[model samples]
Target: MSGDGEEDASLEFTPTWIIAIVCTVIIFMSFFFERFLHYIGKVLKRKKNFALFEALLKVQEELMLLGFISLMLSVSQVSLQKTCIKESLMLRGLPCKRESPNSVSHVTFVRHYQTNFPLDFTGMRMLLASESGGSGHCKSMRDWKSWEAKIQQEDDTAEKMVKHVHELQFIKKRFKENKIFSWLHSFGKQFYGTITIDDYRAMRLGFIMMHYKDNPKFNFYKYMIRALETDFKKVVGISWYFWALVIVFLLLNINGWHAYFWISIVPFILLFIVGSKLEHIISNLATKVVDQNAIAIGNCVVIPSDDLFWFKSPKLVLFFIHYILFQNAFDIAYFFWILTTYSFGSCIMGKKAYIIPRLVFSGIIQVVCGYSTLPLYAIVSHMGSRYKKAILPHHMHETFDQWLANAKTNKLKREETSNEGTVDKFWGAWNRKKASNKTEVVAKLEEEMQEVQHEPVPEIEIGIHN
Candidate 1:
């Protein structure tokens, strides 16, 4: 009891322990009483309680970092706990008396992961069966074909699974081809009149040389919008001023603005650097890469638009099925807006709007961006468009065909009415001119040229010399 000294020296409260306790409280509040906290925030905001509102948001941010902090703490403790007992045994990988989470080797962790995740045995087995290249996990997966390992034989269902060893091997083989493997193997047959795994492997060889489909997007504004949507995260972070403001705010909040006012100069320089010509080039580069790889995969072009799902084949049946999913509660943008406004804050400063807050401006921007970003917004907004029978008789291709038809019609009209003439118009003008020349009717052009040539140059006086 005397050796304990009323408790171990490690049990004493420190800054780290205090921080951990605070984080635990915040995480608990965030998880259990999120709505209540928001309500309290709204009430505080309405009453113009600045300090409390700011404090609440600070806690919210702590809640965001809670998971990350917990992970770091666990890892740190595992690597350092043995040092508490003896100085000489301060080795990083020293094991504690109890089975620490760190003691669970990578293989054990992965086994647990494969068993629990996906919540479906078929999916778990399929994922485990994937040939992760040359990793030790591959060896484990290979060993799964053997009789000793029980993972291949175990099932949650009370009904007895196949007891035979060969049956397990067959299931393992079946799990290896989970995705479009059969379909990928069929592509050579569909295109080249050959169906084999060899053909699929051969397709991989031409991966470097494969060409992608490119959209002939003549509309600059529309194309630019699409580009922005594809990589909005990258585009938004281009502003050095935004980063400067963020850094300054953090420094001031952390170390008292007056105490380290000079510390802000560095961020100001960064902001200035961002607005310079060099920063402009970086911004342009980001914009260039925006949607360049949208529909590109390896060297192959998957689809014309980045709006569609990546893995889904661009077939008529699948396209309509995707459309049905779109129609049914695809209000993801609205959800984001609500969370940002209510949970984050109405202002850039994390304060309530009360007046013309940032949320209002952001809402407008979000609506514009979402509509420009995808045709689903338009199709969904237009009620009864889904049920328009004449447009899509079987709904096989669905609103996608309707959208395309409208797009084509608008494109044709733009071509007709645009001030910038097309290739056809240029050729037509050339042909007409040729016909006129052949008919000997070029007098107007000759007279115009002669008039230009014969026109006298006006004499100008220098300063007051005239």
Candidate 2:
């Protein structure tokens, strides 16, 4: 009996080790393939955006994207590898050859899953569950009670994967059924979802795909044209903020800033012209194409009048925000680049240039710009513009119009009565929309609250395991 037991253990151990080694190699190859795909994506995006010259600012952006994608792939690869290792160990230790990878190896569906490498099984399950449900009475069940601390200790991989699958499915199913539920859940999940290395990887491809799907006529040249337009504005914006620092460097120049004055002026003037032209093009394109989508989608509720100048669509507002933010961020980067280049120039010229002053000035400017931008973001967000519009009954519009009039009248009274009171303009719009879809929002809100109640208590806490 003792000899037989030893032989059984030996038989189990050898095959499991072989399988694990093979799987491990496959995982490594998958990671390598992902990296290759990422580089291809980057080259394509850069070409499309026409960030020619592969200039300092554009190069930095490319590097950041690569770093983020690599980090995400690393995290996911680690998680999947760890799970495989754990299963391998279990198979090796146990006397059960039946549980080896070979057991599921023959199953066509399982083989397909292994081949495709889908990141969001939870999403698939949720979509399936929603399709299974009828008349918007969607429901999901999860056995949270079995999720005890001891169970995790005994089966960490199984527990974690199961929990992740359950939570994601729940969110996805709820998203399809309720609008308010979709907004809150989607927004809330973004924090945990995109905040991680793996989450970044998962979303990066989706982002690329989404943009591509939106613009199918997207040739390399068109992409390059758009990219060049975007980048020109960015470079020009940076130049504006760096003008003061440039003057200071000119004063400190031993050969005299005058010697290279024309050279400097040419670049600055060219940047300004390019920036202005790009900004104009982008704005016009947005108003024409982007606003049209907003109108079609019903996202133009707040600004229903033909008063495009006075009341901007949410989509246009967002585009302008991106325009400003991108420009400012580039500007901040340019200041730092100047600081670097000038410091180098000073070193080569044997001038005693203390970079400390430049660093201090740069820090102050960045802080001021960052703080000033917050209000702009808030106003843009509150405008309640979206690319896609919510579909509602015709009666809802009349109801919303009445609510808007009341809210507008109330806002006017407050503004007239007190100098401190300005229009709570965005909320006034929301109040009007709610008046129109009083039934829909209310029903959606109620459904979301119930979902909150039904959600399984989170099994893992960051600081403590529960």
Clashing residue pairs in candidate 2 (N, C-alpha, C atoms within 3 angstroms)? 48-223, 48-224, 49-227, 72-197, 238-331, 297-389, 314-385
Residues 3-46 of candidate 2: C-alpha lDDT, one tens digit per residue: 55546545354577677898999899878856874675577556
lDDT of 1 at 322: 23
Q: Against the correct fold, how does model 1 do in TM-score? A: 0.18
> Candidate 1: misplaced stretches above 4 Å?
1-69, 74-219, 235-264, 278-466
Q: Kindly give the stretch of ten consecutive residues in candidate 2 with the minimal lDDT sum.
A: 136-145
RMSD of each: 30.3, 37.1
lDDT of 1 by residue, 1-466 (tens): 1355435434453357676998999898766777886887999678754434554565455444544645665566445433335423322222112246567665454343233211212221112112111132223223322322332243424454334321332122222232355334322222221112221212212221222113221122222223222222222111345335434433342211221223323322332222222212212222322334333222121112222222322222223322222211112222243354444442211223222332343333233223221222211111110212222222334467788899999998897776456766888999999998876656877778899999998999778655
Off by over 4 Å in 2: 1-320, 341-466
- Candidate 1 clashing pairs? none
TM-score of every candidate: 0.18, 0.19
